[model samples]
Structures are given as structure tokens and as C-alpha cells.
Target: MIERKKYMSLLEKWRDKKVIKVVTGVRRCGKSSLLRMFREKLSDNGVEERQILEFNFEDLSNEPFLDYHVLYSHIRKNLCGDRMNYIFFDEIQMVENFQKVVDSLFLLDNVDLYVTGSNAYLLSGEIATLLTGRYVEIKLFPFSFAEYIEALPDGTPHDTAYRHFSEKGGFPYTVQIANDDEMLREYLTGLYNTIVLKDVVARRKITDVMMLESIVRFLADNIGNLSVIKRISDAMTSQGRKVSVHTVENYISALSDSYIFYPVYRYDAKGKQLLKTGQKYYLVDTGLRNIINGTKGGDLGHILENIVFLELARRGGEIYVGKVDNAEIDFIVIKGEAREYYQISLSVRDENTMQRELAPLQAIQDYYPKYLLTLDNDPVVLHNGIKQMYVIDWLLQN
Candidate 1:
């Protein structure tokens, strides 16, 4: 496995810290592999095997230990009192009342704990209230463009690599099956279905599978477009799905909780406040979008915007869609008190497109750095003050 250096670095930094390291992400985004990699790191750094305890509740063999009492007893009995003990739990939500196990384990001064879960259910209810600030959540994602480049065979052209990456997406397993179109489609389809069925459907106890799927398809098709729950509900109803606004909100919430889609709220750049309505959602991975929409998903501009959103997310910041007066800035990334504005487009080679994209960024006063990213192959240029860059080059940047 290509080491997930970004997340690995986080795990390494938090090693032996008092807080429980909770790794969360969408299924198939490699949370389990990341934990395993960190396990190796610990061993290589002189942590003895006897001092580490790793449990993956998803395995059938672990069924015997599914009871929190049995699992806690087994782990507690294995603790090495002479030295620090490292405990890693994969899919901790699979165990009944796992929060109690985590709380009990946290009380033990001898162990440094880590856990991974596919959805937000792992941290809600009793666990959220009990743990409070005792845990540090490290959210994970599929490969960044830099990692995507590293995963490809040595010496592939950058343009070719990015094209394939954009089409097939960054799921680690894709590195192995990308050459086989049929296999790639089947894998993504199965994974998407599993996420919807296991995480979204099962957790929410949702009955309308067809409506749930329709919602997924709608979100996949409308990435980067500003939408509200009522609009989505009305559209689906008109199409005969007949879902209530409350039901649509619940379904979308479950999807977000599963890490399959992210809803970015709109910020009033002029008023410096978050708006109550008009926000957008972007899928976790473009490959899943491709699988769900099939050949009908053609708008490359929105797809490119979707890619940039994921990239910004990996870089770590609060991202929002910015509306300054009537103009819409593609993204506003705020880190602490500072903010960076961005506009994404397929190309601004046409003067009209260039002006349309530039108008929003220019409207914002107080320079926090603005950029216009496009797929066009060109040297970096400045439009007034906004930096115009080749989107591929931007994605490959550290």
C-alpha cells in the first residue's frame, strides 16, 4: 500500500498523546489500511508487539468478542502495565455499546487508543456526550492529486495521469484495477451500494430504497450547484418520488454523516455572515459520481469544481460558497481569521468567460489572496490581482 503520509503524519504526531485518535471517513477511502500502516510505524519505531492491541470488529472471528464486556475484558487482560499500550479499533461501531468500552479504555492510564468508523454514528449519542473533548478526530479522504501521482506506475506523463485520476478517481484500490474499465465500474458500484445500504439505509432505518437512490443520483448530478432542501424536495416530488421536505433533509443528513457527500453552506461575503439558505453539496469522490450518473454527467466545469472542493478539504479549512452582492465566488476557505477566495472554471480563454469568473473575485475588498483555477494549459497569469492558474498544476501543489 502507498503510505497515506498526510494522515500518517497526523497519527505519528498524536502518538502517545492523551487524546484518543479517532479516524473517520467514507467506506473504501482506506481508514483500515491507514490504521494498519500506523501499526507498522509503531513497530518500526521500537514499540514491541506485546504492547499493541488491534481489533477489527468487522472480521467474523471477532464476533465472539462482539459484547463490549467480552471485548473490554480481552483488551484489559492483555494490557502491559510495564509500558505504554497502544490500542487500535477498526469499525468500532460494529460492537454493541462500544462507547462504554471506549470510556472504560480511556480511563486506563496505560493505553493510547485509536478507532476508525465509516460513518458519524461512531461518535454520536452517549459517546459524543461522554468523550466530549477527550478525542481528536482525524478525518480522512481518498488520495489527493499528489498521492494519486505517487500511486501511478513510475514515469507516466502528468497530463495522462491526471486525466485518468479525474475519470477513475482516487480510491486506493483503483490503482490496481484502473486498467480494467469493467472491474473499476463494478467495484465502485458495489462500494456505493454498500455505503447506502449499510451506513445510510441501515442506520436511518429508511424504507424507501428507490427514493434514497433517487436522492443520491440527484446529488451526484447537481454537484456545485446551489440548492436548498425544499427545492430538492419539490424537484423529486415533481419527478414522482414524492418525498417530504423533512424526509429529504433526513436522507441528506444521513448521506453527509456517511461521508459520501458534503454540504457547503453559503456565506454572505458582503455581510460577513452565513446565509440561512442557498448552499451546495459535493460528492466525496468523482468516480462514484461517474458510476451513478453514467454517460449523462457531462458538465466538466462543475466536475472540476467538485475536484477543487475535495482538494481544499484535504488542505484543512472551513470552506464555503461565497456570495458577494449578486456575484458568486466558487469558494471561500477560512483558516482562523484569514480567508482565501477562489473561482473555478473549465477555461477562461474566452473574454466573456474570463470577465464572468473574474468579476466575483474582484468585488471582494481587503486582499486575502484570490485565485481563478481553470483546466486550460497556460502559464500562471494575474487578472487584476486574482491569480489565474492551470487547475492541474494547482492540484499538484503542496
Candidate 2:
């Protein structure tokens, strides 16, 4: 494991707190691995092995707990009398009525609960209501470029790693096994199908699996584009597939719930208003996008933008697609009272491209750190206020 210091720090913050620690992310984005790492940390901290009750619903041995009663009883029976029990439930959402079990265990003073799930639905409607303000959700994403570089061979150049990262993506398992592209693609495809079929379609009782897949693929292929439900509906109709605008929106919601694609709302920072019309969708992993669309030739800029979006999200910022006047900023990340603007481009070499990339940040008229991240080696010195840096270098820095 290439130690994720950021998430580890979050774990330290909520280590023994009363609130439940919920880890959520896309399927195979290393949520389970993060739980395992934390469990090891607990052991290293002298937490007794017996006091930890680890249950993975994905494993066949735990299938009996699919029923809420059995799950509750099993947990209740496993509780230690004197010591505080640390319960680590991996993919807890797989069990029906899991909120009841979580709520019940949370009521006990002797238990510190940590749960992992692949989708946002793990904290959806009822679950959110049940654990309202009583839980802290720590989102996990695939490897950032820094983590990606750390996983690569020692002799690999920064450019090589960046290219591979752009092409293969930052999915942890995929990054680890670099030899077999075929196997990696297959695994990503299967994971995507499982998330769509089991988590979204099956769990939500969605009737149109084919339409859902089509909409998902369209979104994946068109990352960073302003997407409107009506446009999506019309496009699908033109392709000889019938789907209502509302149905398309519902499918998009399902995808978001499953953590497959994250839609970024446009925030007009200057105007101080949130726009409701158009939004951008970013894939959890570019590798999965490649799998869905078959490694295409163009759209490298959008892929890079998606990577940066997820990275900012992993850093625990509330991200928005920033719109200032007619110019657009790729992301505006706000944490507490601090905010930063970012623009992502594959290259700012061309004069027009440089102006286009810097225009949004220049228009902001604020002292906040504004950056333009690119793959170019040449240092750009345009726009007195905006900072220009290589994306990989930026990722390596704090």
C-alpha cells in the first residue's frame, strides 16, 4: 500500500469518536483496502484482535447476514462485555435494512463503528435521516497522481507516469498490476457492470438496464461537457433509443448514487448564485471511462480535468464548476473559509489556448490562489495573478 496520508489523517481525527465513520466511494476505488489499513492501524495501536468484529458482506461466509435480524443478532452476540468493540463492516449496504443494525450498534456505548460502502445510497434518504449528524462520511477515490507515481517503478520518469496515469487511470488495483492491460480492462468492465447491475439497477428496481447503460456511456464519453437532460433525451431518441428527459435524469441520479459519475454543479462565484441549468459529469476513474468507450484518441483534456476534479474531492473540498461572467473555471474548491480556483489543460502551449485557460482565473479579481495545471514542461508566465505549474508537480506538492 502506498500510504494515503490524507485519508490516514482523517482516520486519526475520528479514531475513537462517538460518531460513526462511513467510508464511501466508487466500486473498487480501494474503500475496502482503506478499511483493512485502518484495521491494521488499530492492531498496531494495541487494539485487541478479539475486540474487532470484521464482516464483509461480499464474502460468501457473511451471506447469512443479508437478513437484518440475523445481522443484528450476530453483532449483538459478538459484543465484548468490558472492552469497546471496534466493528468494521465492509460493504454494509449489501445487507437489507442495514441502517437498523447501524443505529442499534451505535446506541451501545461499548462499540466504535466503521462501515464501508461503494455508493452514496449507503447514506441515502433513510440512512441519512437515521444517522443524521451522528456520522462522518470520508469519501475515498482512486489513486491521485502522487499516489500513482509512488506505485510505479523507481526508474520511471514523471512524464511516463503521467502518460500511463492518463491512459490507464488511477484505479489502485489496475495501477498495481501493470503487466496485463487486457486483464485490467476486463476487471474494470466487470466492476462497472456489477455496480450498475447490483447497486443501481437491482437495488433501485430500475426497469431499463439498457437505457441506463447507454446514458452512463454517453456521460462517460462526454466528460466535462455541459449536459442537459433534454439534450440527452433527444440524442438517445436520435440514436433510435427512446427515453424521456425525466427518465434520463433519473438514470443520471442512479449513476451518481452508485458513485460511478459525479455531477458538478455550476457556481457563479462573482454573482453569488448557483446555476441550475447545465452541469459537468466526471468519472470516478478514467480507466473505467476507457473501458466503456474503448481507449479513444481525443478528449485528453477532459480526462485530465476529471482526474483533477476527483483529486480535489479526495482532498475534502466542496467542489463546484465555477462560472464567472462568460468565462468558466474547471473547479472552485472551498474548504471552510478558504477557496481556490483551478483550470486544467493538456497543454497551454498555443497562445490562444494559454489565453483561454487563464481568462477565467484572471476574471476572478481575488487574491485567492489560482492555478493552471498542464502537461507542458515549459513554464508559462502569462496572467500576472495565475500560477502555472505542471500537473504532476502540483500533485506531488501539498
Best prediction by TM-score: 1
Cα displacement (Å) at residue 240, model 2: 1.8
- 1-398 in candidate 1: lDDT tens per residue? 89988899999999888899999999989999999989998999999999999888888988978899999999888999999999999998888899888888898888999999998988887779999989999999999888999988899888898778778899999889999999999999999989999999998999998898998898988999987899999999898768899999999999999999999999999899999988899999888888888956469888889999999999999999999998899999999999999999988999999999999988998788999999899999987789999998999888
Candidate 2 per-residue lDDT, tens place, 1-398, comes to 87888888798899879999998888888888888888899899998988999999999999998898998898889889899899989999888889989999999999999999987878988779989989999888888888888898888898888888878888888876667888888888788889889889987789988888899889988999999889999999999998898889888998898888899999998986789899999998888888888877788889888888877887777889999988899999988888999999999889999889888888888788899999888665546878898887877776
How many backbone collisions does model 2 have? 0
Q: What is the C-alpha lDDT of each candidate?
A: 0.91, 0.87
RMSD over all Cα atoms, model 1: 1.1
Model 1 TM-score relative to the real fold: 0.98
* Model 2 segments more than 4 A misplaced: 380-382
Q: Give the TM-scores of the predictions, in the order they appear.
A: 0.98, 0.96
